[model samples]
Target: MSKELLKGNVAIAEAALRAGLQAYFGYPITPQTELLEHLSKRMIELDRVFLQAESEVAAINMVYGAACTGVRVMSSSSSPGVSLMQEGLSYIAGSELPCVIVDIMRGGPGLGNILPSQGDYFQVTRSAGHGDYRPIVLAPASVQEAIDFTVLAFDLADKYRHLVLVVADGLIGLMMEPCELPPFQPVRTTRPDWALTGADERERNVITSIYLKGEEMEGYNIKTQERLATIRATEQRWVEHLTDDCDLLIVGYGTAGRIAYTAIDEARSKGLRVGLLRPQTLYPFPEQRVAELAEQVERLLVVEMNAGQMLEDVKLAVAGRAPVDFFGRMGGMVPMPDEIVSAIDESFAKMAQPA
Candidate 1:
């Protein structure tokens, strides 16, 4: 395949289509609007389903309905827009439906701004809705990754019969880079046995989240937890740089991690033994790898565009085996490589001090 210079949002949209996306339902929001705009025309041209719903809430429900019919369905939105879909998200998860959701994060506790931010870490990794369920979350740092992960999100969702979220900040969404998209996959024509394809000759296959009885609900909850445990054990993923021999470790993800990679390279040039662990799977979180690295490093530093949201996870992984420090810029402020390099120096200084 030839590499084309593509904006992250458009790349993801095209990649999803090629990956056999049969239906798309979403409303436009900044940073991620291009994804929906691209799908609106392409889906129609391909004789697939595409509907611009009245709101995010409606869009998510549309996705839910399509997914129940066993088609590759998705929706894209920014932070606030994603919040509006939370209730719908919970319903889909509770029913064990497979679907993909793309969240291009913008500044926000409340309609913060249109700039990039990583404040959605907890919202995504913890739970996208009010439920005892944790959706699989993938954080991509580059335009290429945005395209790649979008494809992977659909596969993982179907494999586990669960929701999958591909999240990136506005930086990745708006940036342009060269990327090679996957070959087109023909959409499936046969519905899964579990799908609600209207009972014809056999007993009806009923699927619902409403297990009214206490024992029924508890039984379903146990099955959900078991599935999550399997996913956590098998799906933890991350990339490491200079980890073999380093006294200081830097942990970040998505945009923050991408920038930190540059800082760590510069620090290495200056004779600093600093490594990096950029997590790709945020929900599974690569905790085991972090725990092993914590034993090798003297200290750890977490960098982020938000106020250390991922920092707490690093601390848990470290488990006090090493000191942990955090440097962050909230409200859509991006940290430069030099700023992180300086942060590394400060961490070293702190390490040199007595406890």
Candidate 2:
């Protein structure tokens, strides 16, 4: 694999192409605009489909149309733009369509500035859309992980016939790092049997999110739940750094995750037995791993680019086996490595002291 330095957004667009993406639909939003810009010219050169939709809403529905044809399709936007695509995300989830959506999060209650923040953690993992459905959410801490996850998102989307959301912050999207884009064999327009493509070789296929009858809807909901259960069981992914035989553990993901590792290293130099647990999948959540590590560590300090969003999940995973504390920076601010190192030292002392 040849290595090249690329901005995260451009690497992702190139990765999607390498992953055989058949179509791309998106509108411009800061930090994520480069993705649209890169794909616009790249898609043209390959004679593939790419559209700068009138809006994020229009873009996602365009994905919906392409996905129904069993083609790998994607759309991307920053936090505010993603907020506008919620309805379409729900529709895609309800119809059980496979597609990838990228959210380069920015601070937002409404049209917040485009610096960098993980404020959309809840928006992506909990309630961005209007249904009782869950998307496979991936958080990548580096440009290489960004490229890798883009390819994995398409596979996971198709594997479950569901939506897969790649969660990033403005920092990840805008930053540059060396990455090896995977070589992919281009997939042509050979629609799947379940796809709604004229239905000539089999019975006609209908793709819609409508289930007017309550029982029919309930049945679909039950099936969706089963799919979620299976995903929870098998799809959880994460990385552990210096976790074994440690007294303090740091938990973070995406941009915050990388910082957590830096803090761990600094703490280690001072002879603190601290480690990091960087989650790659937010929804399935590496709960079991956290629980196992919690059994060994004295405390867990959750570092996030938001006000303690994933801290709640870490608390649940620890379940009183070990104490869980939080340190976060919201609204486009990032925590300094020393700040986290200080928190680790300070929190560990208090937790370790006999009362």
Candidate 3:
């Protein structure tokens, strides 16, 4: 199959189109504007529903409305924009609606900058929205992986009937690469039988997130947790390199992960016993893998482009069995490959210290 050289944002848009997106509602921001722009034209050409909503909040609610009809709906936004949509996302999750959300992360805390940053990791993985619901989080490091995850996101959204997040940094959104686009499938506009279609199925089916009774809400929470448990057991994915023979393990996700892989490779060349573990799923995080690697390595290093956002998770996974260290570059700065290699050298030196 021939691959198309395309920007990551555009590639993800096309992948979603092929994956049978019935509706798309979004408000544009930098880095991810290309994705919405591409979908605007493609969705129109395909005679599907595409709306440039007035604001991020309105856009996500639009997705909520479409998803209730059992259609494949999506919304994309950057960091600050995503913040505006949190309430809507929580409502969608609480209602058990299936929709795909694409977040091309930018610097944060308060419209920091348009430059790429992983500052949203905590907001995405830990507190996507208010409440205890967990959305499936997929962190794609490359343009090709972005496309693959976009396609898979739709399937997972429908299979589990819940929100699925496709997370990418501004770098991934802007970078261009050759991607083998997935095959296009015919989309169905008909609503599912369980949908609210105005009494056409001999009964009034109501869809809602509001449970008036306390006990009823608890039951809903339990059901959501049970499904989340199955997802945690089945969806953990990661890449391990030279971990089997190493004494120090470095873990990262998305861009930082790619960099760690290279740094660990170079460290091995310099006779350092360091390895790499790159997580593909941010939620349902590879905690089991982290624990297993802790048993083999002397120390664990958590690398990120934030102020150690993921570092907390790595600590929980390690659970004090092996000491864990954090290395991060906050704001818009990126950590270099040599910097990670240097961190590995320092970890060894620290381990040699008497505790």
Candidate 4:
């Protein structure tokens, strides 16, 4: 294994190649353009397919096409570009195409800005692509996690035959850190007997999400829901820090999660019993863990880069078992450690009852 200091986007690209990803389709977008460039340069040397599609829509559809061929494929974009790709994302979900889509999220809600933002939380976790489906959403907090999650994303996508999204922020994408590159894994080109790959011995398989009859769609939805339930039960992942004897728990993900870590450490140094609960998998959210923590902590503070988007999930998890409060910095502004610590202090103060 070679050790190198790499940016998060480059780490993801390298990880994808190591994980046996054979195809990459994407359009240039800020914060994630390095990912496309890195993959474009490396894929050619590896004799892999790398297409700079004309648009985000085209890129996602290209992922759809390549994925249908049973190839390990991926695409990535920032928030606005990802928004444009939603139509194809919806199609990918409906057709059960196994591919990974990375969103190095930037400020959004319509061409907002090209800075790190967690505004896409609801979009990714809730499957905002106009469908009753859920994509396995992985939120990476550091550059190392970015690499690890990219590999995990592919495995999960292929295992479940569904779309998996690596939902990171621009900060995580742009930051540099030491990363140990994993050895290249052999590509799996053998399609399952069930995958759509131009029938050789069996009948032609048609992959689609369109069911003309309402009853058929309802049945599909039920199956999808059951699968999601199983995933939630077995796949929820999170990282806890200093939670064993804490009065306040700070919850966040991605870059915000890292920032919260610093805040939690600072609060502990100052003699405050503060902890952190960082959800690594945002979709198969660690709701049960948060609920269990709620019983131990007096207050739970949800800190995010958006205006309380993740706070909703935190509150839902706590479910009145603990007082949940939100602290956010919007429009791509990330909160410093002091700001987050102050938020935690304020939350605890509010939770302190009057005599």
Each model's lDDT: 0.94, 0.91, 0.90, 0.90
Query: Candidate 3: lDDT of 126?
Result: 74
> Highest TM-score: which candidate?
1
Question: Which scores greater on TM-score, model 1 or model 4?
Answer: 1
Q: What TM-score does candidate 1 get on C-alpha atoms?
A: 0.99
For candidate 1, which ten residues in a row score worst on lDDT? 198-207
Task: Flag regions of model 4 displaced more than 4 Å.
Answer: none
Full-model lDDT, candidate 1: 0.94
How big is the positional error of residue 43 in model 3, measured in Å on the Cα after superposition?
Answer: 0.7
- TM-score per model over all chains: 0.99, 0.98, 0.97, 0.98
**Model 1 lDDT per residue over 24-134, tens place:** 999999989989999998999999999999999999999989989999999999999999999999999998999999999999899899999999899998989997989
Model 2 segments beyond 4 Å from truth?
none
lDDT tens digits, residues 1-355, model 2? Answer: 7889999999999999989988999999998999999999998899899999899889988988988999999999999999899999999999899999999999867887887899888889884599788899999999999999999999999999989999998889989998898997577557777888885677898888999999999999999999999999999999999987788888999999999888888999998998899999998889999999999988888999988899888998999998888899888888999899888988778776896
Instruction: Quote the positional error of residue 216 for candidate 3 in Å.
Output: 0.5
Give the winner by lDDT.
1
Worst 10 residues of 3 by lDDT: 192-201
Q: Model 1: residues >4 Å from true position, as ranges?
A: none
